[model samples]
Target: MKNLYEKRIDQTKQILAPLGEIHTRPQFGGYGVLADNVMFGLFLQDELYLRATAQIEEVFHHHQMTRLRYIRRGLPLTLSYFQLTDAGWQDPTLFLQLATLALNGARQERAEKQNRERLKGLPNIGGYLESLLLDAGISNQEQLKAQGAKACYLKLDTDDIPLSIKVLYALEGAITGYHEAALPAEKRDELRSWYETRHPTATTKYRR
Candidate 1:
């Protein structure tokens, strides 16, 4: 006989199938639901939890779903995962709607979190430079990438704070997810060219 949680896991898969292929793997105590390796749902005991964002969280509230909570290191921690109320289980159409919202939120959250972690590890993208980027409305490494390193560097109003070529190297490392020292010679040369042209006192110029 399948356990109650197991049956709920199966039912959750059925409800989520319309979204895409729902795969399951053993999680902490129950199962995690994934599509294309992206986590969108979680099953624990008799309840199912879905990702919640500021916007989609209202759906959980509308359905009277509670946020999922678990203990870690003897501390109660509540995550963005929210329980699906009876309304979610009884209606497959509603389930798919809520599931898609949850998945989108999860994808965005995961991406930002991954970018933040990556940025923290990057050379020249420490606390202060990150603050400058955020102040300039560049939130994450992905956004920094969309603007490109030179554009972002030029965006910084460094009238009091000295801007140098090294900051450019750091931004490149942040974008490529590698150390600035690992950057190719051509890329470094290109950065130097842009920097010299931008800096009023930079005497060097691109020979070509």
Candidate 2:
């Protein structure tokens, strides 16, 4: 006695099950399709729209896939999800391949988001630097401040992670809640002096 949308959800789940732990949950007047808990697809009115990142969007474009959009307050708002065409649905191999890419991309985006949250309130600490800090065992703002910028810089250097002297300023700024460019001249000079004392031969100029 399932409705058309309910039956479509079951069909969609079966098609995506090969990617592992496929499930659906109600979302934004539709159903969000999740692979192993990371949402990577959307189902609306029996049409499937796969989640997409910038990289995956290019692939979807190449396949002539259209992005999902809805009218909100008379304005059309396009989303990151790309529709799976009838041909795409008929081809299980291509469908799963794109679905897999979407799932991986979604997972990566989620991880980056979580990492940014973990390092929130730390100036100049975006995803790449956040990862570096996590790799060096400096996971959060409190840990970074407690260890001090010099120690954190040394930890990164010890791990053979090549970073500019600006990172040193960035860490200090993170502690003081100042933008790296806005760091006090004296503090900047002190940090530069410390760096010179440690690695005298280095010639990496400071840039914001």
Candidate 3:
């Protein structure tokens, strides 16, 4: 079954070779062709489909070409695939356009997938920092400066806890801090003292 699929994939590449450079590799269930490392199309059961993007999607609509669906109840999938309109494979220009559209669509799809994956991996911060940042709409450092550190921290009780965690978060914010506001090395050192005080045991273990 695998060998048969490989043969069909090879044939699909051959059919597309004349149009331009076509790269074939195993993907999803069957085979995909990429132009410039961006997926332009795919082959399944020896049929070719091109990616569809917002701008050129209407071209696919006019011809009533089938939109490829990957996952149910997930993102909507669109592609520019068509069976040969005629017996001889006559429309070279149309083929090229469809292939280009597919490639662009695939690039967008891959980018969105990466963004979704990254958002899922955000670290958890305690309620104190979370509420401060959230209330200020400062999910990241860019927003941090606009809100100002002193104001942001005003709500939290500073006297009760050792200063280390606060300093560490500040240092982290400095390293990633946006263009508008960034903590200096001295401020980071002050935070470092808190870290040393709070995590002396753990710090010693790592130092060894």
Candidate maximizing TM-score: 2
What TM-score fits each model? Answer: 0.53, 0.54, 0.40
Candidate 2 lDDT (Cα, 0 to 1): 0.76
List lDDT for all candidates, in order.
Answer: 0.71, 0.76, 0.49
Ranking by TM-score: 2, 1, 3
In terms of TM-score, how similar is model 3 to the real structure? 0.40
User: Residues 5-105, candidate 1, lDDT per residue (tens digit)?
Assistant: 77777887787787778888764456768877777777777788887777888878888889887653233545567888887788988888888998887
Q: What lDDT is obtained when candidate 3 is compared to the true structure? A: 0.49
Where does model 3 exceed 4 Å of error?
Answer: 1-20, 70-89, 105-208
Q: Model 3, 92-119: lDDT tens per residue?
A: 5665555656566666655664444221
Name the runs in model 2 displaced over 4 angstroms. Answer: 1-3, 115-208
The digit string of per-residue lDDT tens for model 2 on 51-106 reads 88888889999988999876532335456789988778788788888899999988
lDDT of 1: 0.71
Clashing pairs in 1: none
Q: How close is candidate 2 to the true structure, as a TM-score?
A: 0.54
Model 3 weakest 10-residue run by lDDT: 154-163
lDDT of 3 at 149: 45
Residue pairs with backbone overlap in model 2:
none
Clashing pairs in 3: 40-103, 50-80, 51-102, 164-194, 164-195
